[model samples]
Target: MQNSILLTGATGFVGGAILNRLHHEKKHSVVAVIRGDSHLQMQNVPTVRIGTFDSDTQWKENLVGSDVIIHSAARVHVMNDTEANPLAAFRKVNVEGTLNLARQAAASGVRRFIFISSIKVNGEGTTLGTAYNADDAPAPVDPYGISKMEAEQGLRKLAEETTMEVVIIRPVLVYGPGVKANFLSMMRWLNKGIPLPFGAIYNSRSLVALDNLVDLVLTCINHPAAANQTFLVSDGEDLSTTELLSKMANALHKPARLIPVPCWVLQGGAALLGKNGLSQRLCGSLRVDITKTRNLLGWTPPVSVDEALAATALHFQEHQ
Candidate 1:
């Protein structure tokens, strides 16, 4: 049976990549829900324009008859959020908006709803050698994460009340072409051969490639075991700050000019500069254990960390 898939965030980074892949594969009929005016011209794929995500917006028309709804759209973390109430702003979209959509989807008889969430839902960072798994209690630390946690709770409740299956995925740092924010900044710095103070930092962090994440999403779209399940996804390989920088440098064909600065010194410097969060990210150990995803779903990340990094570097270079 050809499943009609309703995809939100089709214009954004991860969603765009998934849209392109689905379009290229031609296995399923796709209806992309985008915001505002769209000039996206793609053959065989229909587009729906929803002005904004809120209580008043109607989604039943676009949601009806869809077999699966891949909801990738959410108010992501803003480094310096300017909103008067950041949590309220996030809740409006990530929580309330998500529940609204899920309600519509359930009423419309949509079979599955896949929600893309963040690992911050697990917490900021982890202890060395300790990895977070799907069973870990949610410890959302920020507004964005709190909103996602609320959305997940709402979705699960909706699932219990209705037949629409809800699959929640909390993915660690996702990197690929068209990536932005801190990952993009790191790539640019590596490309320019900037010396970093993370050489001695031995903190392991897990990351998922865009392709790997999309692959998992596609798997969950049809997999029976994925129904009403929550997952933590990563590349299955972990890397330290220095190791990651070195790998990125290799991908960029540049020398890893890293100075060995103690983790304490880095933390102190970042605190002095009012960049404590940034320092934690640079020096913290946050790993994900994908044993459950592997054993339960029978899925694996197809792209290696090296391959993904190289592709990202190449794309960055070409775009530059």
Candidate 2:
């Protein structure tokens, strides 16, 4: 049974990976939705061009004969957001735009809608001994997290009102071959053998490999238990800042040049530099318990962290 899947953010990291996975699996028919023209070539997959995604963006013409909707596109969280009314700006795209698409998908008789949400919806950070689960009450702190929380709320309401099965997946920091931002930056610093101040940081954090996340998305597509379920996903292993850096260095065949600076000193420096949030990321603990995800979906991350890190390092080396 081939399901016609309408995929948004097809040009993005997660969505593009999903598209490639679907293509290799040779199972489903995919329709890649892009905000503009793309040069991405696929054998039989077709592309749908649309304008800015918003409350009023027309999706009817593109929704025809679509069985599933994978909504992975959103206004990502950034450093030092300068947008006035950041929440409103995020809502216009994440909440309003997402709900708008879900509303239209329901009306158009789309069977399932897979939403890629963030773990920030849980909260900023947790202690090393505790972990966030799907049933935990949401405590979004930032505009992006708040928007995603609102979007999830709206989607749950729409699912109850309609027959569309909604699957919400909250993933921790994602990393893989084409990862960018902080993860990539850390890799670059490691490759150059730069001394980092994360040696004394014992904070535990969870991560999901790109392949693992894509596998989970594919699982939720046809799984009956996935309907109306919110799942927290990770690699099922937590790593401290020092452990992570060493692993990255090992993958890159570089020496881990980490200095054991006191955590207090780093926090104090961050405070002076107005990088408190950055400091928290480098020093705070954030973990997600994916027990429910595995029990319900009968799935586990197939890619080991070491394997994924090696692939990421190889890609970085080739490109550099």
Candidate 3:
């Protein structure tokens, strides 16, 4: 049956990819909800402009006739937020805004709600060999993660009280074309043949490609088994920092000029440079075990890491 789908964040990086995927499939009618008129123009997809997520904005009209709602719009993590209360700022959008949308969607007869969360809901990093799984207790250490955890709780409660099915997905670092922030910085540095000091770092991390994440989101849209379940998704292959940089260099067709620096030295230097968090991210282990995601959904990441990296590099080269 052709389903009427409501997709939020249709203009952002990951959301745009999801929108393209759905458009190409041509199996569902999509209504994109954007904050303003600045949205992608598609041939048949209609758009609704909702200014903000406060109480005054009415989402019911948009929710009507929508069988599924993919809630991807959120106030993402601000690395250097100057707000007096960062947690409150995040909760205003990520928590309250999300619940508001879910409530309206439930009331409007939406059958399913898919929420994209972060693996930071688990913690910052993991031990050397251990990987984070779905069963791990949530240990959010930052404002953004706390808000996501709160949103997940609120959605689960709503599901218990209503008929709408909620599926929560916690994905690790997602990378692909159009990716910005630290990932983009790293790619640019690699493209310029900058010698990085992560050659000796031996920490493993799991990451999901944009295409893989979109595939998983589509799976949860109507899959009966995905109802009321929390999933941890990744590329199913883990890599160390050194290995990752090397692979990225290969994809960029450049030499991986890396200098071997002691882990302690790297951490100390980062602290002195006011980038301690960056150091942890570069030299820490954070792996996610996707055994549950695989066994339950019978799904696998369609793109390999090498292929995804190559695509990303090619896009960067062309855009630059």
Q: Which candidate is the best by lDDT?
A: 2
TM-score of each: 0.98, 0.98, 0.98
Where model 3 places Cα greater than 4 Å from the true spot, the runs are: 41-43
lDDT of 2: 0.93
Rank candidates, lDDT, best first.
Answer: 2, 1, 3
Clashing residue pair totals per candidate (backbone < 3 A): 0, 0, 0
Clashing pairs in 3: none
lDDT of 3 by residue, 12-69 (tens): 8878888989999988888877786676856677888788865356787788789999
Model 2 clashing-pair count: 0
lDDT of 2 by residue, 1-320 (tens): 67999999988989999999998897998988888666565667798888788999989988999999999989899887899899999999999999999999999999999999999999999987999999999999999999999999999999999999999999999999889999999999999999998888888999999989999999999999999999999988899989999999999999999999988999999999999998999999999999999999999999999998999899989999
Error of 2 at 164 (Å): 0.6
- Candidate 1 lDDT over residue span 103-219, tens digit each: 999999999999998998999999997999898999999999999999999999999999999999999999998799998999888888888888998889999999999999999
- Candidate 3's error at 134, in angstroms? 1.2
Each candidate: RMSD:
1.1, 1.0, 1.1
Worst 10 residues of 1 by lDDT: 36-45
Model 2 residue pairs with clashes: none
